[model samples]
Target: MFSIASDSAKSVRYVLEHDHADPNESIGPQSALAFALTNEHLTQKLEIVKALLAHGADPASLRNPELNPPHRDSSVGDDSMLLSPPPTTTLEAMDPATRYFISRADAPQTRHLSTLLQKSLFRPLGGVRYDIVGQDQVFEQLFTVLNLHSRTLSVSPLVILLCGPSGHGKSFLARRFGPLLGVPTHTVNVTTLRSTHDLWDSYSMSPYEEITTRTLAQFLLENEGKRCVVVLDEIEKVEEPKVLYSLLMPWELGERVAGTCSPRAGHRHIDVRQVVWLGTSNIGHDFVFEFCETSSGMSVSHGEYLELARLVRPRVSQSLGASLSSRVTTVLPFVPFTEAELMAIATEAFYSLGGERAYFVSLDIVEHVSRKAIECYIPEEGARSLHRAISSLLMDMPEFLEQSNK
Candidate 1:
C-alpha cells in the first residue's frame, strides 16, 4: 500500500481500517509522524499526513523510545493513548534524530503541522529569532560548537572570529548569534578607542569612558546569570595592541576586573563567564577574493576555498597578533555574494522601499540593476555597493507607480 505514491491518502485510510494498523505505530524507533515528517518523499505529501492524522495519528510521538513514557498498546483494543513525557535533557543534549525532526518542524512549510502538535512537545527547545539570510552551514557550525560548550559547562569562552569583506554582514552575523543562544548582545567598535583604558575606564573621566562604563554596567547587570554575545567590530583597526588584552580575561577565564588606571578603581569585577565573544575583521579580504576568482572563469569550489583559507591563516594571525588569534575557537570566512544572492538582496530592498508596489517593478529592471551592481562589484567593498545600486534603481519608483496606475 505504501508503494503507491499518487493514492497515498486512500491507501493510508485503507491500511488503517483493514490491517487495523496504529497510525502512531513505531517503525524502527520512528513513529509514523516522525518518519512522515523527515521523509523527503512524504513531507511534501500533506494529504498523506492529513489522512494519518484523521486516523488518530499522534503528532507528539518521538523517535527515541527512551525519551517517551511507557504507553499501553492501542492495537490491543484499548484506544486510549498515554501522553508522552517531557524531555529530560535540553534540546542540545538530545540525540541527532530528535534535533533533525525539530529542524524539519521549524521549516515555514511545516509550521502548520507543528501548530497541530502539542506545544509542550517542542517548547523545551528554546526559540531563536534569527533572520540572517544565506550561510546555513555557518549557523549550523555555530550552534553545534556553542551548544557543545554549553552542555559541558566549559570555562573556555566561546570565541568566533569572522573574517570577510566589508559589508558582507560580519557584524550582522555576530548580532544574530545572541538570539539563537537565547542571550542579549553588546557591540563595541574597536577602532574608535585610543587606549586600553577606553574599554573599561579612563583616568580623567572622559565622556567616552563615561558612556562605555554605563553601557558595560547595564549589560552586565541585565544579563547576570545568563550568557551574552559581545561583538568587537574591526579589531584589526585598533591603534593600541595593549587594549586587546581586555578580551583575554573574559575569553579565557570568563571574568573581567577593573584595572588600576580607572575612575571606579576599587576592584570592580564583572562576571562574564557566560559571555560569547565575536570579533570581525576585513584583514585578508583581498586575498580571499583573488583566490576565488580563477583564470578559467569557474568559481572556486567550497572545499578549495576552505583549503585556501587554511593556507592564509598565518597571514591573518600575524596581522591580528598571535595572542588574539590563538584564543579564537574558529575563524569563519564569509565569501562574497553570488549573482543570485545579489539579486535577492536587491529584490528585498525594493520590497522594503516600495511595499506592495514592489511587485509592479519589472523583472528586467531588477535584473538590470543586479547586473550593474555585479559589474561594479569590488571584493573589498562587498554588498554595500549592491545595496546602493538597488537604492538608486528605486529612486524612479514614483514614475513607475504613475505608469502602473495608468
Candidate 2:
C-alpha cells in the first residue's frame, strides 16, 4: 500500500520482486490493486501496474461489480477503498493497460502480454555469465544448442547432455541454467529417486485410479506452456537405465507419459513441452581430459569442442542406451579446469570463507590455503574437493576454532 502512495515504480518493483508482496492481497478495506487504481494521477502508475501484473496481480479482481455501488463497503467508514476511487475515475478513464485486463466486446482476442512472455528470456551468447569460470568452450556449445532450440516455436523438449569430468562445474552450471534465462529450474538427483517412474509418480486413489500429481509433476503442470529448465543431475547413477523411458515422452514429444498408476489414458499427457532438459553425467570424463592432452593447446577451439562432443555420443549411448542418446540435441563436454583456473577458483572460494576477518588476512593466507586445498582436488573429483580443502585451512585458523583463543 505504501508503494502505491509513494508513487514510485521502482519501489513497487522492489516490493514485488524482493518482498514478494501479493498484488491481490486484501488488507483492511483496500487491496493493493485497488490502491494502485485509485492513484491514476501518479507518474509511474502504469509502470507500477505492469510490474504488479507481471508478478501475478490478477486483472479480473479489479472488475468487481459490487465495488461501484453507492452503498458498497459502507460499514468500513473512512478507511473504505470505495472512498478513494471516485466514480469519475473508472478503469475506462485510466490508461489502456489498466483496461487491458477487463476485455469488453470490442477488445482484441489476442493480448500483447501473452505474446510478450511467450519468448525465451535468455540474453545473447556474449551476455552469458563469466562467474562459471573456465568452461568457455562448454558455454559456447551450450548457447549454440539453446539458439537452435528456440523455445518460441518448438513443441518437443530440448535435451542437452552435459557429460564431462566431475567437480569442474557441470552441476554448478546446471543450477544456474534457469536463472540465466530468467526462468525456474527444477533439479532432481537421479540417485535419490527410488522408482523408475519417480519423475511423475502416480497412485490409485478411491478405487477409481484417478490421476493425482506430486513434486516434479506438479512443478511441470504449474509451469505448463511456459519455458523452464529441468536438470537431472548424475543421471548415470540411476539403478535402472530403463528409468529414462519415463522421460522419453516429455523429452521427445513434450508430453508426460502416465505410468501404470493411472488406468485412464484421457489425463495421461500433462503438456510439459518447452522444457530444456539437462542431464549431467561423468560418462565422458576420461575422454574430455584425454582430448585436452592430445590437442595440447592453450584453448580448445569450437571445432575441437565439436569433435569432443561427438566423442561423448558413444559414451552416452553405451552407458544410457542409443534411443535416449539419439534424442539428445548435443552432448557438451565440460572440460577439466586448467591449473590457473583451479587456483583461481580456490582463491575465490578461500576469500568467501573469511568473512570480514578475511580483509585482515594477507596474500600468503590464500596461497597457503590454496596449496593444501588444491591437493584434494583432482580431475575426476573436479571442484567438489574444494570444500574439504577449505575445511582443512579453517582447522588451522585460531579464529575459526570451536573456542577462539583470545
TM-scores for the candidates: 0.60, 0.61
Show the colliding residue pairs in model 2: 167-383
TM-score of 2: 0.61
- Backbone Cα, N, C clashes tallied per candidate: 0, 1
Candidate 1, lDDT over the whole model: 0.56
Which residue pairs show backbone clashes in model 1? Answer: none
Question: What does the lDDT read for residue 75 in candidate 2?
Answer: 53
Q: List, residue by residue over 305-334, the lDDT tens digit for candidate 1.
A: 556557556766898778777778877766
The all-Cα superposition gives candidate 2 an RMSD in Å to the true structure of 17.3
Best by TM-score: 2
**What residue runs in model 1 are displaced by over 4 Å at the alpha carbon?**
1-130, 179-182, 202-213, 221-224, 259-269, 295-302, 362-369, 396-403
Model 2 off-target regions past 4 Å? 1-120, 124-128, 202-213, 258-264, 397-406
